[model samples]
Target: MPETVGDYLLQRLRDWGVEEVFSYPGDGINGILAAFEKAGNEPRFVQSRHEEMSAFQAVGFAKFTGRVGVCMATSGPGAVHLLNGLYDAKLDHVPVVAIVGQTARSAMGGHYQQEIDLQPLFKDVASEYLVEVNVAEQLPNALDRAFRTAEARRSPTAVIIPADLQEEEYTPPQHAFKHVPSSPPSVARSVVVPPDDEVGRAAEVLNSGEKVAVLVGQGARNAADEVRQLADITGAGVAKALLGKDVLPDDLPYVTGSIGLLGTRPSYELMRDCDTLLIVGSNFPYTQFMPEFGQARAVQIDIDGSLIGMRYPTEVNLVGEAKGTLRALLPLLQRKQDRSWRETIEKNVSDWWDTMEQQAMLEAKPVNPMRVVHELSPRIPEDAIVTADSGSSTNWYARNLRMRGRMRGSLSGTLATMGPAVPYAIGAKFAHPDRPVIALVGDGAMQMNGLAELITIARYRKLWSDPRLVVCVFHNNDLNQVTWELRAMGGSPKFEESQSIPDISYADIARSLGLEAIAVDTPDALGDAWDRVLAADRPAVLDVRCDPEVPPIPPHATFEQMKSTAESVLKGDPNAWHLMLQGAKTKVQEFIPNRR
Candidate 1:
């Protein structure tokens, strides 16, 4: 039905509802690229600077749309480069389809250039589905399976096309392996409801304990109303995993912000003292942040049955979709009459926010990092999509940025990879140009993968109807998060110099690429810079010179951490004094206990 296998593949992609395909061109993929040019451009081809960025962009597309984001690369090196981002999709349970070109069939087993066994190379990452097309006839079924498996399993899938096969004419078989649909296949995500017995048992465990804490993850994002109802009925304090940042508004009374090192003080205290833990859709890896294995009677609910009780010992485990499972459990749950537990956690949450506000206002030589996020949060549009790179910027985003109303956003969740923010923002903008998209990245990550994507942004910005994407680069000139973790992990402050990055002007680099760029070094100018960037007509970058010395202090501190900070200061570290002032000033107030 098509001139070539390549054309057929592109047609299948369009039929599968893929509007854009992120890719990096190479000689091995020449045929597919040529076919894309000939396809009349309905499914637009986006050329990314790096194969990895293309994959990350695909990941971002999947994250924003909840559909199979498609990406393509050449054989050997280009295909290999997609592994990291593909793993990000797999580990985070996002749907993605990666098409990789291979050496011509005649060149196979002869060790030709750019020829590697891609099946084994891609097997682990695209664990759900992977196949190589040896002949033109195999293309349709393989492509169909790729999309279906990616959707059903919610993981990355791969289809490898040999260079020769891609150029050959493809004729549909009268007796086809599978029915090639005339229209787009509608993959329905059916509601998975756990059995009545499992639901009843979980409800019982939750009702038996007085102090309940509800921990949620990305799975519960769509069921915020149900989550709030559960928390209300059970007198539970809701603590979100980093991926579930938008599950509940920060202003919610019983919400404890986030959990773990990047979490809020109220979250730590609530987890430490809770009598029962009702975990919904989160396999929170940090066992230390949760109550002792058996200390709290735990009830865990998740769509994937294998993940239940993987993090904590559970008294009851319900295997089902979060929204349906939660809806089923709410009616069976006994509403806790005691408001004291809920009030205590809410009071702590309020105090933590107050402390954060004070820290945000503290004036310093270089602008305080928290101050930048503080200024930006209020200006974010209600429907904006925000992505944060993995580093100190994530710390500020996790602790400072507030997601309210219908606003949605995400990061490199399970992979926690850097260099995703910029590309993720680009993909999100492409997915929904009507909504504002922002990327919060640190200097280190910007140097790694942020700059190349600007070229991609510049290329496609005009194509977007409301291309108001913003890249907020935190120019701290160091891998600040790693430095802080080194100090917090009982290491000395003297080693920080080795990790220091050179002073780089991201705004200058952005301006060179034809993006409207501005650099703000002073605390006073940060707000105005953000306003200008938001109000700009095209894609822009706002580079803020953030303080490298300030550490992202965890909500709860250990004596070892305190000693580490003191030891660093005693050793004459230049930024140690500011760290001490920032950390100890409020700690005294917290430990002193207000004398009424």
Candidate 2:
């Protein structure tokens, strides 16, 4: 029996080592679905309730595994649904391959049912590579190329297969088209080292200045030890971009946490006072968080030359992989003997941790969310993978979680989308079955894409490799971040009911899905709930009713923010006092000197 076009595509995906392919079924994709079933689940097809959820899972998989994530969708609306999540992949620089089903080739441009022009639809997001497999014989090669391009560019790629052609028998291309048969091209996996002159120039800029600072991003993830070596040699205080939070151990003496509004006081202070800044593989966008132009001599290193000076003004630019470039530059860097600047920053870091501990332990009626993160931080296994949703919960996560040992993390990051946390944990769990996975999400974000994913977890649950995914949902029943943002931005905090959501019992929903779950309303109950969830040896959800009054504090506040707070308080905002107290608590120590 001859192979069908759909079978060939499935076989190629399996050959490419795709363990699971997320999809939402529709008529246009029936051919591929049939082929998937016929293939005996070699690349298991994981069904999602929505096409968007499928795409989100793909993005999460790519983020956690550092490999190409594959997602499939039906024609028209189903294919259209993937754009939002695919954009997450594009913006975050994760590799993803979207297999979209199209109407029959003959029906295209005729406005038939479920027919839409997919090439133009995906043009912007899948700009790296987007093509239709109009020719049945070219699919094997085109599918291969899509995966290769996605991996090489670390961007999303799309390949549309028309329904009519998908079931057609596979045929070899004619001699005219197949003049040569060659091996599939390999994606380059080696690191590129910068030229000696480039490294020397970067070293010269660093060696000439005192009070050096280093900012790292996801691109520097694998170069943590090298970054530490660079920091040690130059007496630099290291700050991380949020996406690069795990690039260095958070407890390192000279390591300041994140670098922007979601960052730390020590990091902000380091950015303010440094005479020289060394940026590694990060395009941290907040210029306000960096020194003014020419305030510090800046040196940037990245594998992509185009991104070298894109974020900050540069005195020297070295184009190479972070680890390789740092390795080459280490030998050339002049060691700074002065320990005063580094020691000062380290002291501030210590003081900042003390302040954080104080904030985490602050008692609140309905459990302070910070307390949950702080408690979970020490209790989770060192090798666990944690995912956080975008909201006020991210504030607690950014400020609290310690990325030590082999612990890993992922989030919506650049896209900063809500509802990726649960799907991200699902993807991460599938990728590393042996590692424990946890997701931190707020009530709003969880209600968006959370419940449907529990069904997914139950469907795929296994005895030995269950992943034991735990979802910690902060059930605050409000869009707390936006409410605080209104006050912080000087907008009137009136009509806040529009920003609020009805209190929903997410634990009940999780339990209905046949997963172990509990709802905890107090801080003391949260610890025991987590212990039960962790020990249950199955996927679980802990719906924590957190204090809605607590504010997500920034490392520093501007005069405008102060004015806004005063205005909101005067306007009779109910949580105004709580916000004020939390904001002051977060920053008060900055004004006091540490006796130790």
Candidate 3:
């Protein structure tokens, strides 16, 4: 059926239903590249600008499609470049498989060109499964195991093939001693449900309390309806983990958006006031954002037993699929008749939105960063997918953008790394070519690698059915997030050499590449600029010059943080006066009465 090991490898990947393999070319994968040409590109090779971008594209595809994403790279340095994106998948619990080339078996002991010990190098990142195929017979089993393990464990896995072995004549593992043959490529599916007794225990804890709060994470994505039903019955307010921002629509009356530093004020108040807590499919690590110890009776539901009872002291831990487990527990949970708690939550949520709008409209030197997302929120299409990078802008994305009508949003959540947003948008475009995709990135992240990814988007623009893919760059020439962190956490002033970055025209670069580009410097230009960019016939870039002095103050700003920030400003921070003015103006919105 196949002439070489490389041909068989591509065939097997097709059998596994892989549609695209994000990759970068090199001589290390020459055999596989040849096989791709022979196979007529059955599993299309989507080339990225760099090996790291390829890995990020795979991560993004897997995240959006809910399927195992595959990536390929050459040996030595190419393989080494994939580590950051692979670690991003690992930390965020996304399923991805990396196929990498290695030096020939003959070059194993000898330090030939592009030869390095790959197994030990990848051992930590691909800890779920890592294998190097030394023989033709080992190819099928190793590749199959990598795909299976990546899906089953929801982690990145690796299969390393020596350069010489890939060109060898294909051979199947025979029914002989010491030979292992893999079954056909298919994953068996099953729904895990916790025992009846555990469900009953969880229900009892939830039904006993009057003031209940529900916290959800990305793991609860499949259990959205169940989560909503449970919240409705319990008169509970639901708060989403940053990773679970799309799990529940923000329009719901009792849905307090996002919990943590870059979270909403309503979410902070919800956790502080609730006497009972129900956690579903979220392993949010911040204990400070959660209810105080010994204050709330808690019940947690998760598919993995190991993750349960680790974040909070739960009265009951039910280990099962989130949707199924919640389905089991819902029947036993008695609906709380009192509506006062729900009313209070709804009121707090309503006021928070008004405060957000007021803050977004505040005057700034050039543009208020919040207004960029604020304008886009209502204008964004119903079925659009949004990606945000790790920066001060993530605060706006988390608190400003409202999820409704099938909108999906994600960021580097646990890893919180820079430079994935634009690549993620490219991957999202591949996943659903019919849907419009948007990426919000700060200047720091945009400079890091996003500028290069625009070329990747430009090259692949014709493949998508919908041509609208927008990369909105927050053109604040500063590493804004870390700068604020230094002030708030380390009590240090902004070190200009380290914190300030050069301002480059991202719009000019996009236009040179023949993509529609818009540069917005004034606050008034943002809404119309969003309109023009979203209506473009091709991939576009919206570069908005924003005020760096604007602070991303946490909802529940600690007294110590305030003191530290004051200290940093007093210590001769360059933007000291402007920062103080912006911080005070933004923080005052919370105390202002809702005009509505």
Candidate 4:
């Protein structure tokens, strides 16, 4: 029997274990859509209001289930709408398959109403693209490759089936391959321990150095205990990168804080001044803080061999599992009480932590973003998923949030985009209804993509009893913190910096959709607000009107774009000057009484 390309596409999808697909119908995709609907309908299709929403929903599904999220859209504009979600999936390493239907093959380059080159547009975001010309002849190969690429790399891939091709029936050949993919390979790399002398040399340098710090990143997730063990053996303190938040519990005594601009002072200063720094599974970027070649001799331990010397000058590069490396170096490490160095750094780490809490988390009048995140973090179920949008909100949340080892995060690198967390929260909730999902987002970012889905999830999930619940903290501050950072790059100051403005009332927007909503302004109201939302057992939003002047991202926000911020600050404030003084104080205090 022969099958149309559209029909064959659906049959292959069923064989690939796709039980459901979230999508928006289009002219380019009608053939496949109908085929998917008719081929015994093993994988049900849920309709969406918009193509972008379909992509977002697909990403959510993938993030939630650790399976590939699939979506279908028509060519040109419809395919264009998917860029945002596609970028989200790519940046966050969420596996999704965007099956976009393009114009008929004959008019591909004749500028049809909806014809555009998708491969070029998708190359950066998708791991691989299957812009199939012949589904009956090419689908088996395309399907296998698309799914494999998406899963193995934890990235999205696309399969564009033209409208004309979808309607043509051809004798589909038997697929030579039947092996379903299992999972992506762990980034962990195995390496044999070094010779005894190398360990002895590393131990000698580590012990002899008066000041030392252990930096942990997501790389340390698998070797938390070993990292702590090494830290204890050397009497060294520990700090984590934002992604490494839970590598060590918040309660550990030797734990100072994370190191970065969106980080604490004590840990940052101690890290900069330490005589011997040990990087256990941390390929932390921002080498600016990690001074040039010999500021503090650094021992690099990571799963990737190439990453060892790639960032900064490494004194010793140990290529192996962090745990394995530490175990090998354990016997060779020299135990000593370098009281002077440890004390100097400890006082600095301690005082900095206190001051940060005061200035940021425990402020009196206006609410602090940190406190909101801190109060919320402990309250959410320990195992529930956490997704963060990139901005002041994430800096605040990442600095204070901790989800013990084994906790899942929908975080990507600095290519932080908004609207992702909201949809990601949706997908994660769908993925693990057994656990709660918390989405930390700033209004500027969240509004860019999330609100439209308010009505869609309810419509889609009613048939299958939706399990995912989201507590969205929508910070309503219309300010981009990156403007001041622009001034720091040797550019003349704009008298009216544009970082202090407030726009968007997300609470009102959310309430219209029949969901619980809370608006809070003061710090005291935060704890109760979060609690109320969590107890609702349904979709909820905590719209917080925060002080727009909050100083959050710089390393994360280096692009100095400002107009409103300058206007807001010049009219009665000198935030650039004020922040300069505050940042100066934060830096100087590091050398105070216990300043390492």
Residues 204-246, candidate 3, lDDT per residue (tens digit)? 8999999999999999999999999999999999999998999
TM-scores of all predicted structures: 0.96, 0.97, 0.99, 0.79
Candidate 2, after superposition: displacement of residue 326 in Å? 1.0
**Model 4, 281-370: lDDT tens per residue?**
776778866645677877777765756867777777877666777888877776656566656666665665554455455342256566
Residue range 158-198, candidate 1, lDDT tens digits: 99998888888877645666534332466866999989998
The residue ranges of model 4 lying beyond 4 angstroms of the native Cα positions read 1-4, 7-22, 39-72, 88-96, 127-135, 167-212, 280-283, 299-308, 315-353, 360-366, 405-407, 460-468, 474-476, 483-504, 553-596
C-alpha lDDT (0 to 100) for residue 355 of candidate 1:
70
Pairs that collide, model 2: none
How does model 2 fare in lDDT? Answer: 0.86
Best by lDDT, which number? 3
Error of 3 at 311 (Å): 0.9
How many residue pairs clash (N, CA or C atoms closer than 3 angstroms) in each of the candidate models, in the order given? 0, 0, 0, 9
Q: What is the lDDT of residue 291 in candidate 3?
A: 98
After TM-score superposition, the amount by which residue 208's alpha carbon in candidate 2 deviates from its true location, in angstroms, is 1.4
- Candidate 3: stretches off by over 4 Å: none
lDDT of each candidate versus the true structure:
0.86, 0.86, 0.94, 0.67
Compared with the true structure, the alpha-carbon lDDT of candidate 1 equals: 0.86
Candidate 3 clash pair list: none
TM-score of 2: 0.97
Q: Which ten residues in a row have the lowest lDDT in candidate 4?
A: 180-189
